[model samples]
Target: KILSYLDDSGSGRVDLGMFYAVVAPLCGGHLDKRKRVAFEALLWRPVNEGGSSQITKMDAVKYIKLLRAIYIPSQGMSEMLEVHGEADDDTSSSMVTFNQFLGMYDDSEWGFGIMSTVVKLETRDRNRHGNQVCSVCRYPIIGSRFKEVKTGFSLCNQCYSEGKVPPTFKQQEEYKFREYGSEVEAMKAKCVCFSMQSHKNPIAT
Candidate 1:
């Protein structure tokens, strides 16, 4: 899911700027910091990367669609635009400067909701395990990691995307995989599995 938004060029590789665009919004910081990240991510071209630091109405709409999925799932595109002080009749040719984007947040209630969502997502990303390596590629896993339930086997996002799995599990009829976004979630799954096993084979008291 992270790759879908960041891989704008469809080259199967994400540049550093694109990677930062996706992650910066999910980092712990003041609300303005996250807002700035979101704004830059909408730019036609990142200022430092050789394009003008300007956003068009179309740009805002596209980025807002992505943000709505993450931050305001309850709102429709038109309603989201209204929340951001964008009018449906606004000309697509108009450019929105950074200050104007910031002004919308300062003038609306949507900023509060964005702050809460960022905090929750940031906490989950922070709790992800840095030590877990992919059982297939043997690299340290980051972002979304997939695991097979029966054997504790794991795969990194890239490996899983390519349908790669551990050689030992190759002959299985089907993969019963579970996805984990953070270490806390994986630990909870382990606890649940242990509880189920204990119930199935209770010891004599």
Candidate 2:
């Protein structure tokens, strides 16, 4: 059944809230990118899916306000996860390639991991909010256009000079050993891994 377009009843236009709750029902995934697209299509940005109305930034903010109706504080509300908890215990006896663990954000070039084992957050500022070291290149990745990505275990940068890209976010750069986040440089970085072997205290600073 189709969701009623009631949410689309914008005060003067179809803001983000109405777009996500109403029209987005016709699409998949969360209401995030979809809402952005709708905003762009309607009035902010252009859309190829056939939309051109234009919207304002204030409108986007207002719609985001409506979303509070369905808000939940927990990112881990899964009953199964609550009951069984995380697999802190190593269950897998075998190892798998990085591709099996992460989603590929881009697919045009060679495997991002094969070329570089590290991928940084890639920012213009020198303040390393956080940086990653790929095993393939063994270089610290930190540029806007850099093909920075992460596998569950490590990050990967692209061998830009050679022109190879990792197939998935879980890859290493071309010429270095894929290393985990550099603890010294990322002085404030916190590990998110849950496996006991990976870290003594997953919540450690």
Candidate 3:
């Protein structure tokens, strides 16, 4: 199903650009790149199945609901989809063109927040594990764990959401964390840093 959606050219094979258009949105990179990829994903359709490229309000609502399912799981789907009061009388206003969608990112603060959350959730590892424990709660980390770069402090998703940090470290007004899927990945990053440093300052006999 995803392949069909991405194969806009209707060719049996998906080209590198086509594949990147759909996959980049989930990989959590530059915000502009993610936004562009997302916009393409929403507008894409096989050339054989020609249709308007503009996304309707309903389309936007459905995408929003999918995001809500991850971040706001407690909220019922019906409640999220419900339209408040009467529907918009202006029919044309309900459609969002590519330019209009881009405008939302430029004009709305929450625009960046929403897209960032979407990328984070899509890229997160949903697998449960006990290989590592959260530094704050001392519980086995599940899914994605957030680690502070400066102090090597880690937090489980719940603790991160609640803004919990290691008691030894002073709480800051804001915290920056790198999300990792597993302890091995964190270790690999450490090893890479070590290798780079070693290259820069090689030992002399």
Quick one: best lDDT, which candidate? 1
Give the per-residue lDDT of model 2 (tens digit) for 1-205.
Answer: 1122223334444334345432432354443454444444334223212342433323332223222222221321332222223233332222222232122211223111221111122222323424554334656554322323343333333465455444553355443332323343333233333344476755667
User: Which tens-of-lDDT digit does each residue in 66-154 have in candidate 1?
Assistant: 45544565663354444444446673667778887666545455432465665777665645876899999888787988988878798
Of models 1 and 2, which has the larger TM-score? 1
Q: Is candidate 1 or candidate 3 better by TM-score?
A: 1
- The TM-score leader among the candidates is 1
Candidates in descending lDDT order: 1, 3, 2
Q: Count the backbone clashes (under 3 Å) in each candidate.
A: 0, 36, 0
TM-score for each candidate, following the candidate numbering: 0.40, 0.21, 0.36
Query: Is 2 or 3 the stronger prediction by lDDT?
Result: 3
Candidate 2 lDDT trough over 10 residues, lowest sum: 110-119
Model 1 C-alpha lDDT versus the unseen true structure: 0.68
Sum up the clashes in candidate 1. Answer: 0
**Which clashing pairs does model 3 show?**
none
Q: Where does model 2 exceed 4 Å of error?
A: 1-38, 41-52, 55-62, 66-132, 137-182, 185-205
